[model samples]
Target: MNQNRVQASEVAPRAGLADISILANASLTSVTGTDMTSNAQGNYDLALKYSGTGLASVGVADKKVLVYALPAELQGKVVGGATVDIDANLLPITPGDIPGVKVLFDALGVTINTLNAVLPIPSVVAAFNQLKTVQNLGAYQKTLPAVVSADGKTISVEFTQELSEYVHQAYVATFGSLRAAIDALQGGNVVTKPLIDGLKLAADKLFDVIELIASGGSDILDLALNGNILGDMNGTLHTTVSDPGAASATVKAGAINNALISADVLTAIEQEGEAVTLNFPTTAVNPIENYDVAAPVITQPVAGQTQVAGQVTLTQPIPDRTTFEAVVTLPDGSTKNVPLAADGTFVVDTGSLVDGQTISAKVVATNGTYTKDSPITTATVTAAPIENPIADYNVATPSVAPLTAGDPEITGQVTLNQPIPLGTTFEAVATLPDGSQLTGTVESDGTFKSAGVDQLAAGQTVTNG
Candidate 1:
């Protein structure tokens, strides 16, 4: 009842035929007497009675046939009317215990003999080894579990889904190597049509025997295993290949035509259902054409001169300006693109640059593949002018006055020696006899009015500051 351990009941109820017909090419008429019995080891033995004209014609000494092994889940339990389900999960025949496997393999060897006529192919020898690996059931038994009797008449078949896949891969590997060998021989023009055609038929026959064993003696080969088994190679083989003729080209200024790069085309040849590309040699062609582009000339913001108001204006006439754009480098070492006007002139605003700082400009032109830069044109940044408004203004002395309680204010006048800034103003301070000072204001009309001076005495002079 344990799932991992297969039971005798599981084996007996499922597959009842111990010896099944694996030689599908040989016609089988009937298989009867499915009296199956099992041991404690969960091994099932079936004494089947088989009747077939083709089976009798083989004259194989061993009468026992290959049989399918039940999967773990379908071992014991029987489902009524679900034969398809059982058939689908059944494993392939036990390769090691098949009665006439050697006989079947010998028959396949006969087919291989025709291919051996063209013997020097190393790949073909490799394919022969691969085919032999498929034939040696003992090699497969190393991985596939089997219980063979001492006399080799009874075999407890234990196979899984992997058997089908392993057999398929083996046969595919054989044909692939065989095809490679054939193509190599064909390329040398040594292999002929009759030889290749005979080899193809022989390959198919060998595949038929392997597939029958993989399918547990069934005539139906799985469609999954039938895909491009022979590499889909068909049609008449082409032995001789035509030589590819010479290639040609033309050169022009600044460009070369791409169509003339290759002088000849190497025709592809088909061998063993695959296309073989031939290597054809040709003379080398240089496609580069020699040429040169003239440098653009810079005309304005003359080199080594002060730029007006920190603005560097670069100018070029249409005839002299052939570049796409002009770049200006500022005193701070920053560069920016200067958009050229329709008249080919551009202005760079260096904005309030310090004294002795410089700005430079150059034209960049490209003719698709090559770029050229004209000689850099540079100019100095202009400095700001100094202002001295105080030096232009002058003030006159104030009037002497005797201090009286009733009238104590003094008046004064100021003069402008030259034009000064519009917002300029002047102030006056007077020291009386008491050592105290009186402060006064000056107007735009050059008039000065002082604060009250009630402490001033006779002969005390008031000085203007």
Candidate 2:
């Protein structure tokens, strides 16, 4: 087994049903849909709805009802006495053939809902993006082998675990990781501020989920919270240092806030089967006032810069001398020290830049401490913009010819306007007297040809051919 690449069995995704009911802690506070359930008449009937329809969410809004497609090894594996397994390896792979292993859960309708976890308020883009990516991959399919009992009465279902199981393993593993990062970071107030801001952002999103589910959209909530990701980010966190290859440049990024968000409040609601809603005072609390952050700045060669890329540029609100140094690093991994310039400005030379190469730079004080300025890239230094004749092009101005008597197509090419590159294909179309049309390609000599003229009648053409 290759440790670097995940195995096939580990990645097989479990089929899913995407809807769920979010009842109040006990006695469903509200049924989102009309009457909650429909009858044979399809009329609303909460009592009947709960009894029938076999409609339940497996924790995803739009996934198919879960029917684990079994691999060969565990043909008759079962979980908690369910035996819907057919052999796929022995079954026909070609169309119209039943596979050897087929595992189906009996008319088992499930109510899938979100298990709210503390999402650090600050992980909007990165965390959400990761969630989306994981969804595409499908929570590592766990319905791998459906086991049957000796008497063929009881059953068990299990799957080869992957990194994903950790996602659902525990809230501590997920949320705890961020807590550890906050504790481990050294930038005093500077770094913690952004982290708090990120958490607050996540809180707002959680509130949105609460409202969506309470209003009959449990499936949407399921999608947002189903899979576990970024749950392993525990303990030590290294600073991300930006690199400036040749000359230095500066990048500015959003600040992190350290506002504390208690995820327990939200998760508790979810535990009780009640949707969580963020109810803030109407006056609103501005969490970011006086966010303490280190003004750590770095002086490094910019990324993707050439030998002559310009010198380092500092962003506004430069950090104090304590947080930043006055030197930059070149592409060769050598340092270009600054004289601790009074005005927070420094320079790098183009003579040190290399041609046909790219580089970047970042600002840090203690020889690779917390990064201050964002990294910036520069195009390779070159004598001039390289010109490639093959890449250049000219579009000839087109000429329009009015439809003539019984004319079915429009035809005109400007031979004198410009010389089109060789292998260029052009076309013109015409509508005949009848309502028909034609189209075709152009030739090297700038000549116009047409098709579909035959489709038009001599006196019945209406529009462009």
For every candidate, C-alpha RMSD to the true structure in Å: 33.5, 37.0
lDDT of 2 by residue, 17-106 (tens): 111211111221112331122122211211001101112221222221111111222223222333222111110011101111011100
Candidate 1: segments with Cα more than 4 A from true spot: 1-326, 329-346, 349-407, 416-420, 433-436, 452-454
Q: Which ten residues in a row have the lowest lDDT in candidate 1?
A: 264-273
Candidate 1, residues 164-205: lDDT per residue as tens digits?
444444433434554555445552234545565655565566
Best by lDDT: 1
How well does each candidate superpose onto the true structure, as a TM-score?
A: 0.23, 0.20
Clashing pairs in 1: 10-75, 10-76, 247-263, 248-263
